[model samples]
Target chain A: MNFAFTEDQMAFRDAVRTLLEKECPPEVVRARWEGKPTEVWASLSDMGVVGMTAPEDAGGLGMDELDLVLVLEECGRAALPEPIVEHAAVVIPALREGGGKTAQRWLPMLAAGEAVATAGLGEAPLVPDADRAALLLDDHDGCLHAVEMSACELTPLDSIDRGRPLFAAAWYAEKDTKVEADFELAFDRAALGASAQLLGLADRMISMTVEHSKEREQFGRAIGSFQAVQHRLADALLRLEFARPVVYRAAYAVARPGECAPADRSLRVSMAKAYAGDAATDAARAALQIHGAIGYSWEFDLHLFMKRAWSLAAAYGDGSFHRRRVGDWLQQREDSDA
Target chain B: MDLTYSAPEAAFRAEARAWLDANVGPFRDASSNTADGFAKLREWDRLLFDARLSAVSWPEEYGGRGASLWEWLIFEEEYWAAAAPQRNSQNGIFLLAPTLFEFGTNEQRGRILPKMASGEEVWAQGWSEPNAGSDLAGLRSRAERVVEDGRGGWRLFGQKTWCSRGAFCDRLFGLFRSDPTAERHRGLTYLMVDLRAEGVEVRPVQVLDGEEGFAEVFFDGAFVPDQDVIGEPNDGWAVAMATASSERGLTLRSPGRFLATADRLVELWRARGDRSDPAVADSVVRAWMDAQAYQLFTQQAVSVLMAGEDKKMGAEASLNKVWWSELDLSIHEAALGLLGDEAQLDSDWLRGFEFALAGPIYAGTNEIQRNVIAQRLLGLPRG
Candidate 1:
């Protein structure tokens, strides 16, 4: 019956908020648009956020995705340019779930925040943050392979989200290359992780627009006083609020997989991802529209979160892709019932 | 965080589902809007009341099990999934009961609620007037203090329109302007009037569904005792807002009903669907997902409500109202779209579509809800 977060979870979330508020402002986010985010990334890694999900035995915090998802949302709120979601949410889970063989080799280094990994679980062709990744996990032909960035033949792919660099890697499962990982689980984790980030992004954009609408007046009154503008922002807020709990519940389901039914595991993540992605994208549109000419400018900070939303919606299982998965599962469930 | 129910909650849910499964079959006679159907549904209401399932969230003294919000939600999901007859006493149960719990005198609750649960006194709302539809503050209904028939009470004079279930209900609760000199939203009193009172007229009004589901209630010197006042005199607006927030959401249009509609829509699609059109399947799937979103959203709100007093729905009620209303229509629209040419027939989906049409208009129009969200929730300026 208790669907609320633990006090510890709220405390941790607040701690992340304080750290992000201090270290990762819009300037930090802007600087990383065409540059590496080494400063904030190292700060986060030092703060033990990079390896948050790795078990404590591996020299990490050993927090569940329930905790990690909250931290990831903070990262999105700050527009922190790091591939930690790929590393912690996708790759670490894949490594841990695949069991001892892969775990024994990479757990210590990854858990110690010394290595950063970016994953491409076949949802997108490009490996996010692959240019800076200490290791890259790619799913080619349904088999996952791991390789270091220095040894891999990879080309950077331009993304709308400039801070998060995507890459197309030329690699296959050769001897000593394959990592025993469940691709399906990695895919679900990626979508769910992206969903958490999108919630933060959407929330921030709406807050930004509301602030702007208050100050930026037209005809001797704030544009927000107009019902037309007010209603659009309200609709965007509705989308975000409704999508939020679905993401949290999905994180809960993903964090404790065995307890959830098999059908719920993937279906929940897909639903979260689809709802969150749509929320973020819609927020971006309304924010841009309400912010007027300033929002369209390159200098304004809204684009930082806006482009992140636009790009994230197309990556790691887009709304349409995740919805199709949901649709497929629903049809299967219905067929069984019949 | 735990989404799974406790053992007792699960047992409660199972008991409710089994009871509904066994009892709902004989009651699916007609739309509960018609006179014949209303009577039949009242019998069902008595069955539920006798079974202690009429108002699970109400206190045990009021014929309810005094269930937790979680258990109540679980019961609602099962209740609607069984396609049970609509709650014949909803105007009392949903709209007035919460207000009574919060502001009514102990005497008011003790006298009104038990009979309400038993369907012995059906209550209808008297909020809207021809002039005060969206602008409810513009209402001109007047109630003056007086001594009539050796009773110390107020005499009501004015009209209330769009009173749902007024045609058959036994009582009405509404606002009355008590001071002529006061402006709009001022000098009003929340009063409960007996529909059987002298100088009161209730003319049945036909809804778009061709049922006398609503009425135009005219009060020309109708007497209501001081005991019927819900809150302080001239503070009716605040008390009615409590009802608006509580009634327009969690208890009124619960996720259960829409979720059930989604399930039925899916079954219809399976019975006769266009396999080749991915777009059609996408529409159906989106409708289902939206319904799930509402369910999860309600679950989240329930968690907040259980945690603290300050985290009430408030303006979030507007967000919820707009969401479920639109989702209800979308689900029905998808079901009808699947039928194509055959959709025009007088089928359940068509009737549902007609009722769904009123969703955006009732319990405060969706437009008004948007304004509430903008002004109250978002702190936007009012022009």
Candidate 2:
């Protein structure tokens, strides 16, 4: 069984990485804290990344989850303040599945970057980028709905990750808002996207820690030379490496849904989300430990990735919830085997 | 990337499963740790070799199917699913054979491989000495050149401990000090020594299970011919690294065994039903996830290798070693906790926990692997 990405996927990933490095540098991320313009989002949208996963018939690029995950990873690496993941991974899929005048109306808006959308489908109590979103896709009572942000009551909530603004909102949907697809699968897609982001963040955190460890001298030598510091970073690397393939597998399952059973796909997504959350936490902790006081400070670039890691670790079904999901499915599998 | 096997691979798997279903006995006998049991395992290996299943991925000339890495993984899955006996020749087939293919001369391969594949000569690794465990270069084992019967050879004299299956193994391979004045790693020479040779001794070292799972081999003047030398005489470190790579990589612990153990743990947890605690369930879930992760990582490695790309695992191998060993321990510990007071009694969980405890300590202890990851992989300066 081959697990190598296609050359085109690799090229696309590189292009997205180049784009993010140029448009969403650390300073650009820092500008979001001061309420910067949404120019970066516009640029990303101009590059057609916002609607990468929407159906071509729905005025989008019609890319699959695998392709979208690449862009989401870049967004996480840059700690991008925009809701590209929500737009491409969560909102687009929900709207496409909703497939009515509601989807037809906003799909073009989202595809053209004229409107931004965020989904409150995760277990998180708050919705991210809710103030800037034109549409809000909410999951309630096992039903998914695409509704306008203005129609919902919003209460701004401060998150540890200041880059992505969060708000606690109560959504009200009319008769035509409900989507006719498996909302569970839609949630898996969202969680899988979050997992991809976490993987990317962990990867970036490790790179930063490694660089810091090599440069930061203590007692006449770089701290990385110390076995204790090295071991902590190495442990972080292990977690990130293992978590990465799980995230990709989840993305693969989502992109090619017919290849796996629904329950199996759900279980895989849970594994990915659970493992990525834990790995990213390990990475953030190690980064902080390696960078010492600087990592914990607001002035350092490390906090940008660390806070997002802390935020995403609890987003879209925390580690324990996803682990429970996995346990239940395993129990079911055991019962079937017996 | 595809996870599904190709048509030929699927057919090969079906063939393997059919043969195993017909030939395999009950779950591997626990008694297989004994000398008699090992003999039975050797017979089983012969049976597999006759069917060209012993070395599924080995070249055809060496009595194998010459299958791809993917096919080999599939074969392992099917083989383990059938609860087949352990491969008595694994140390030879998996570790040494790969090195032989990489570094051995044509003559060496011709003489050594056929017997190894057929289990006519079971091999043990003699890398660890009493003085050299984690730091293998500290080994004082020496092999001095000699002219025996007008032929160039070396006389081995030293001790090698922690050789798994050494008590009954017919041959062993390891590094020796070829140049006394040379530095730690430079003077080493990789040699294939016969355990049955004169002045050789094998003393069993009983493990916690009260079985002679390993042994300490002492050489008084064990003779190894010049042809037995692998790679150059003084540049054996590179050769040893290749074997060590196999030892730490996919060869030493294939995903099939871990997957099987995870399955067993799940079954045990499920049998409790209402008695299944949430904590235990969570641990089981993590174990299952780790096993799947290991499987997927291995698939990715195989896929990359198949694409003709050499992704040096290096420290990543250490990461894998630590991950699987800990995962194994956690799974067993969870099962034992589920068993509660009954864990005091003899059970698979107890045996598994005992075995898994050695996993981190062996194959260059998990601590050493972490050091490698930190220093070699993370670019951490050596302390």
Residue-level lDDT of model 2, residues B290-375, one tens digit each, is 98999888888777778886633555688778888888898788788778789999887898899899989988898889899888
Highest lDDT model number: 1
In angstroms, the error of model 1 at B363 is 0.9
The CAPRI-style docking tier of model 1 reads: medium
Misplaced by over 4 Å in model 2 are A122-125, A334-338, B30-32, B273-276, B309-313
TM-score of chain A of each: 0.95, 0.96
lDDT of 2 at A271: 94
Provide the global lDDT of candidate 1 against the true structure. Answer: 0.86
lDDT of 2 by residue, A1-338 (tens): 77978898889889888988898888987888677674788888778888787778766898888887777888888888987778888888877877878888888889878899998876555788887898888887778887788888999786788788889888776678887667888788878988989988998999999999889998999898888898898899889888888988988898887898889899889999998999999999999988999888888899889888888888889999999988878766634320
Scored against the true structure, residue A154 in model 1 reaches a CA lDDT of 85
Which residue pairs does candidate 2 place in steric collision?
none
- Across B1-383, the per-residue lDDT of candidate 1 in tens digits comes to 88777899878888998899888898975456777887777888888999999999999998999898888888888988888877779889998999999999999999999889888888989999989989999889899989777888898988999998788888999998998788887888999999999989999999998999899999998889889999998899999988998876788988888888898888887779885578888889899989999998899889989998753577889999999999999998999899999997888899899989999999999999999888888898897
Candidate 1 C-alpha error for residue B280, in Å: 0.9
